[model samples]
Target: MKNEVQVKGKFHYRLIGWKYSIWVRLLLFLLLALIFYMSLYVKLVPQVYDIQLGAVSEKTIYAPRQIENAVATEQAKEDAAKRVQPVYRVVNLKNDALIDAIYDKLLQINVDEEVKFDDKVSIYRRVIPQLISELENQSVKTLRNSGQYNDSLLEQIQQGLAEQQYQLPEEAFFKLPRLTKEDLTAMLPVTKDIVSKLMNDQILDAQTARAKVAELVNTSNLTKNTSRELVTEIVRAVITPNKFFDQKGTDDARGQARESVKPVYINKNDVLVNVGDVITEEIYARLDNLELLKDKANHLPQLGLAILAALLSFVVFMFVRQSTLPITYNNSQLVMLILIFLINVAGMKIISLGQNMDYPYIGYLAPMALGSILITILLDAPLAFISSVLFSLMASIIFNTEHMLLFDFRYGLVSLVICFVAVFTIQRASQRATILKAGLMISFFSMLTITAMMLMEDQFSQKEAIMSLSFAAAGGLLTVVFVIGLLPFFEVAFGILSPLKLVELSNPNHPLLRKLLTETPGTYHHSVMVGNLSEAAAESIGADGLLCRVGSYYHDIGKTKRPSYFIENQTNIENPHDRIDPNLSKSIIVAHPRDGVEMLKDFKMPKPIRDIAEQHHGTTLLHFFYHKAVKQAEEEGADNGIREEDFRYPGPKAQSKEAAIVGIADSVEAAVRSLRNPTLEQIDSMVHKIIKSRLDDGQFNECDLTLKELDTIAKTLNETLLGIFHSRIEYPSELASKKTGT
Candidate 1:
């Protein structure tokens, strides 16, 4: 009874596996059309970052040519020298205004001098007179410039100047509004009042003049020099030659050799060289040469860029075709490509806009790694390979101007090796460890490729090659680190079924399958064999083998609810079908798939595994029960008759790759297992025949599996099934009985 129920499970799975819905194919076709349309509109052309002649760029170098021809007047020069000096204005306690300015104003310099409130006001009062004089001149000039003779404008200007007395001390740094004539005139009347106010307040005592003034005036003019030593610094700025290296006072090393100084003569055949310096005269000559680029001065390689773009685009087209991964409808795939290209553009701009950016080794951090990792993970090997080649070309354009091909090949080769290494290493395992291992492999390969590219150039020294190799190593490490970090984001965002998750479900210890194993061991044993068969078949088709195995494990979990109804869960039981009505028997059996899907959902299985649990049987008729119902009606002379469709399992068919693959493997496994004393020839015939039946029944309607892949899957299943259920030469019934009875 257990064997019969297991056989039934297999039959249902196989029935769904061989279908290919026309709708799925049509959807894929539409997706390709959209992708093709986008890819075509994107023109693949190389850009030469041509620098225009005499374009306004921020020039930092001090040119000797810009020096003034007219010599400065001695008096004016001397005056500027005195004025521009960094003179720290120490607050003289004798001047009240100066002391007030020091305490109230945000000083230009830090000072530690103590100033009495009386002296602060006096000091600022000294500076105010000149400020007011300059303020009135500016206001009158503005009125004259207005070209209006109105007295109101003149009076208003005078009134505005009247308000300037207190604010006169504020400089341009204070952002005070410009003064008018009225402000100045008004201040004139109050100027004496301000002085009187400070005198009454005892804020004026003395005035400490500037050093220039102190030097010019006699000491007798001052009442007393009681000012503290405030370290009033004055900077006499002179554009003198950098005289720090001028050692005229020191004895010359060439002193004695001056009279008998002989120029060092070099013999053409024997030249003495210094240590740590290259002695190549030819190389030294090259250092002094600088190319003066002129716009439209030389022919631009416009056509050359076009040709390169064509070749690259062709390679890209080939790679996209070979992968057989339909990503045109996938928004994630489109977004990834867009992001990668934008990074490439930004990197190119960085390299081109550079004035003294030391590149050829300082690969832009983003494009070098993020692009490669994304291509390898999102796209497959072929697409990654093509992108790597294109990126190599872009790298050369990004890093090189005169020698564009050199850097392009160097980066391109490194990227290809890293991407290739990435795809292969990660194709089997979705674990973090695999990503790290892939990184290590990428590092080695990238280093090797960089080394080869460097040597081929015949230009770089050993040290330079080592630097390039360092860049390659960094790129490899970055690829691994970034992709590994980004994996969880992709998984949750896209509901991705990575290989690692599939592996976890494929484990024999999974709880739902374990319950089946202990409670209904027959079902468990059958599932295990089915898992093995499906895995091999799925692998042959390049559909996830782990997914096939894992899906098969939970496919029959509904059998647990009605253990006795299922043949595999029954133990030495009388046939329940004999006593029960045929309709009841059919209901109990057919409910397993729907019940299993619900149980799988409750256990929180991934959608693909859940899909297999439900979609394994598709909508195929339960022929035995349907025929039994017809027979019962005929025997009992019942007027009512039943449709065969009523006995079918309600289904959407195998709607995805893994679901379809599992369905085929499930059916083939049960059919082959149910045969008692089955020969190798019978197993071979049964598996093929089961697949053919499914294909004819249109069970595999909603998946992307092609006929070629299906054939491959079938062949793989046959091989694995043969190995597991391999026949042995029967010694005899007597030998078999003797061994068993002992």
Candidate 2:
């Protein structure tokens, strides 16, 4: 039976080894890349059409994926630029300085009393022309080096100043000489005030400014008509156009307006043209820019997508290779990971199809947490975290509807939040129902994330917000359904022993456990004690405590075959080992490990449980039967030929930390159980002795049990055993109590 079990176990190992080969791993990665490529192919490389400009449309065309409508975008930019009004800059003409110079010239003429009134008038007129000519020439020279001087600019300046050169008429020249010094002094301030006020305002045309000067002067403090007339003429001569066309400022403003106009998009499934409509230049250009034209098909997007797929596959491959998780070493687990990725991506793709209905929030219903939750429960949480980020990235791309954008960050952010929430909430899941709780957590966080994204938009739509929240909540519930439905398939197909499965196996009502309990109650009780010891010890070293406990429940199942022969189930019956030969008794004792393995295999127990049952004994000698045979041989004075190897159980040794710890716990429990009220010292000594014996025998060499971990296990076992077997106090007898009462 042992040989037969070994051969079957070897066949199983060979099958697993074949799947774990290097070529198989490479092929699995290739398949993963292929799945990514196929899922995104249509979105990346849209269909092209065979239509021409000005031709009658044969069929209605819609955008296959989100793309920027370059023609429409440019037109929008042009419209925005056109809407920007022309910029005008106010030019400082220094009109106050010109008015002050005119007043000073009049003062100088008034001070020259040596001339006749007619000669003074003639002199005033000549000096006014000279001062105006000199000032205008100086103004032109000042603007020449200012970089604003051009032939048209200079011509505009001359035209604007044409009103300023009011030739003092013969009548006005005579009026200016008649004015007294007091009149001239009062007129100076009025003239300056009117010119300054008019220049301070934006004077686009000098003629418009001159028309307002007379009214302003009349309203001033100048009461004399001649003084008012002189001030009006002087103020009018100085007022030129202060506002000019700013060509550079206007161009910059238009450029800014153009830049401020966002690009127009042809969203996925948006109609580009309708049937029976002529293919105008605008529509033809839009199709051509989108690369929808037959001869203008662009393959670069597809190539870029393929490269991205390959890169993602390579990153996953490298991560698995470098990961310390036990499942990462298993090719079957790698295939399962890829399958989970595919399922999540497919879910995103399915939801993305709703984009055609013009529902942009449909991506919120993608069940983004499904893959991370499954991974956290079935595999490792750290692996699930890394995979969650990747899934979010894929979701962003798959659900994108924005023109010319590779990813929609709104979807990515929501997906990332939900995926992380699912992983954290379900990492320690011990039951299938825990997935539902995780889904609720994912849903709550997803709604918050989606709401945050919506609030960031320029405009908020209550209907869209409500739809997104509904989809997010539904997605969480949907994830729970998917996880519950798919978990069993993955567990069964891959022969995985998740925490939920371990919890189920630990139940005492299991068939093998029930058989052990009914047929060999003492051994069943011993196994339970061993499970307690093993679980505490395994947990001390961060091993799988539940696995150790479940394995211990069925470890002694083979004892049910001969309950009477095992001393634990002997009860009041005669000692079967004393009546039988020592050699036969040794054979009976050593056969249990092999028999237990066979029974477990028949029951389809997981490989970890089977390994524990098969390797827990680990070739340790049955000292009682071996010592008894040696004594019998010495007394008979004949060679019994009792080889020490023949008394030991055949084993591959404990192959894992949990198995090693279980073996030590099994030995420690049996040794302590035989003691009559063992003390803490005795229990501590027994636990250390068992562990030390195994360590010295090289039984721990096959596993990764370190000396420090073993010491920790021994301390934990000693503490647990002390709790179980602590001393109890005795109470007084009834006769003594009655004598004391009398």
- Prediction-by-prediction clash tally: 39, 0
lDDT of 2 by residue, 1-742 (tens): 2322222222222244645567888889999999888877765666888897889999999877566667899999999989988776666656667777877877777777886889987887788878777777677668876876565565566666664466666788888777778888788777777777887888787778889887888788878888888788887777777676666677889999999887776777678889988999988887887778886777788889899889888878888878877555568788889899988888888878777434678888888889998898888898899889989888888887775777889888999999998988898888777888998988899999887777778477788888889989999999899888898899999888899999888888888888998899999999999999899999999999989999999888888888888888989999888889998998888888889999999999999999999999998888898999999999999787888898888987887888888899999988988887565666777888888898888898778788999999999998888777755311235446766994
Reference-based lDDT, residue 184, model 1: 28
Query: How do the residues 309-349 of candidate 1 rate in per-residue lDDT, one tens digit apiece?
Result: 45554555455445445443344454445455445445434
Error of 2 at 363 (Å): 1.3
Tell me the whole-model lDDT of each prediction, alpha carbons only.
0.54, 0.82
Find the 10 residues in a row with the least total lDDT in model 1.
234-243
TM-score of each: 0.52, 0.65
